[model samples]
Target: MSHGQQTDSERKPQVTVVVVTYQSRNTIGATLDSLRESCDAGLAVVVVDNASNDGTADFVAAHAPWATLVRGQGNIGFGRGCNRGFDLVATPYVLLLNPDAVIAADALTRLLTFMEQNPQVGICGPAVQEPSGELQPTGALPDPWKIMLRPILPGWAERDMRHVVPGERPQATDWVCGSIMLLRWKMIEEIGRFDPRFFLYFEETDLCRRARRAGWEIWTVGEAVAEHVNAASAKATGAHMMWDTIAEHYFRSRFYYLIKHFGWPAAVTAELGELLLMTVRAAGERLRGRSYKSLGLRLRSPILKLPVFPD
Candidate 1:
């Protein structure tokens, strides 16, 4: 690197990275190390451990003592944990990263530079790939009808299509994957932080939805790349053993997201529509000589039990 380039790099905007962990002992270290390489100066990392019995907090305390660790009172969930870490950040830019995601030093700097250059963009993300190097969905906000159709329709019907990577180019998008997002502090201050009601899923969606409504543009820079281990924390945690409980949280959060934005009528309609679609799918499977094993799981979700308005 030339001396001029090194001096220019030192002038890049400061960034604060917030990583919320839940039984993420297996993955958090690599994530922290990646962040360390992501910047030589002007970076603060906050790790909020949500009562991980797996010694995730202790590991952070012992190994990455340079990071600011906040031990949560309990398993307060992802959004709440991020909020806890966010409170400690005073930088102009904030990066919310998953405990199992990795971004190269150049990629992190590219994202920071992108945001700095495009002042209109409130949030930006890199082109993300799975651990296997397969390109993941850039980003797409799901359609309510498609979410309701699920098994009754094609496989892609309910899949997340929220945002996308621009293929070695930069483009404006509505939102980006929450796994690794670079956010402008001013935009967050104007639109507020992640909604705490979302214990797990849909929190970032909710925040991005608000960002769009607040007239903030979200972008995805394809030149920057990130690797994400999908659901690493969720799978490693006891949540995998306690899937039913986890499913309930997901369904309830989904329901709350639907109702909060689209209102009660849409949610009620969606719940009934989904049940109807599942029934149709089950009948079709039975006629085709296959048993629909997921019927019981869907029924057990108890999405109807969630309130339209917070009680």
Candidate 2:
């Protein structure tokens, strides 16, 4: 199969690109355009639009008619939305891409070749760089203790505590960021789709952890590079304005991840650390004449009541 050419069988797409979009009208076009560069490689594209009021769906329909658009009923978070898109893929390989990320013209081809050469590797991601060309730390495994201590500890100390370090050479990792994940179909069949319990954050970490536990190797292909507009969709949704809400989701997901993998003790310790951090933040905000009520409430909310997770 070559770039932009449809397979004769037509029943099997070699690669399926799944992009989940939410209020991404401004960036989705460029993302689709970049994917078009690799369409000849027996590629199938699916765009799952999470009920964007901004006509993001309509924009995709008009701009990239080649992509099958799944119109969501409401704002399903990234993981769930990706699962929805996955339901439509029959390809052997699926690439979970972000609407604000653009891969190099040959990026998909390089990733496919790498995966073909290494059958044991189930999931792989490219070197993610910001639009300004700075490398993004998308290849780190989640460290509960480090995450809990990040706010209180210095950056150097936390760096030392982390297990995976991003490097130029291709290497195995605990998890790759969800931004541009290329996953083998067999792995998904074995381990299952992403956990819906995680709405926004830590979902990818959970997926990678599960994959690793299932004996699948996660890798980073340095040759395959992507430029991501970091947090573009989140910013569009006013995530910047609702710092408390964002922090709430992050901490809730973090607690759930820790509890599931490490145990209740770890989760409890993490929650306490977060509570202390939020209390100090709220106090400072109040002293500075800023609204601190939401932060205080986040600190007080029961850990079990956090969104989308079971007790």
Q: Each model's C-alpha lDDT? A: 0.80, 0.79
Q: After superposition, how far is residue 18 of candidate 2 from its true place, in Å?
A: 0.5
> Which residue pairs in candidate 1 have backbone atoms (N, alpha carbon, C) closer than 3 angstroms, thus clashing?
138-163, 138-164, 139-162, 139-163, 139-164, 140-161, 140-162, 140-163, 141-162
The C-alpha RMSD of each candidate to the native structure, in angstroms, is 4.0, 4.9
TM-score against native, each model: 0.87, 0.82
Task: Give the winner by TM-score.
Answer: 1
Candidate 2: C-alpha lDDT = 0.79
Predicted structure 1: lDDT: 0.80
Best by lDDT: 1
Mark the 10 consecutive residues where model 1 has the least summed lDDT.
302-311
lDDT of 1 by residue, 169-271 (tens): 8877666778899999999899998888788777888888899889999888998988888754465663442244567677777888888888888887887
How accurate locally is residue 227 in candidate 2, as Cα lDDT from 0 to 100?
A: 81
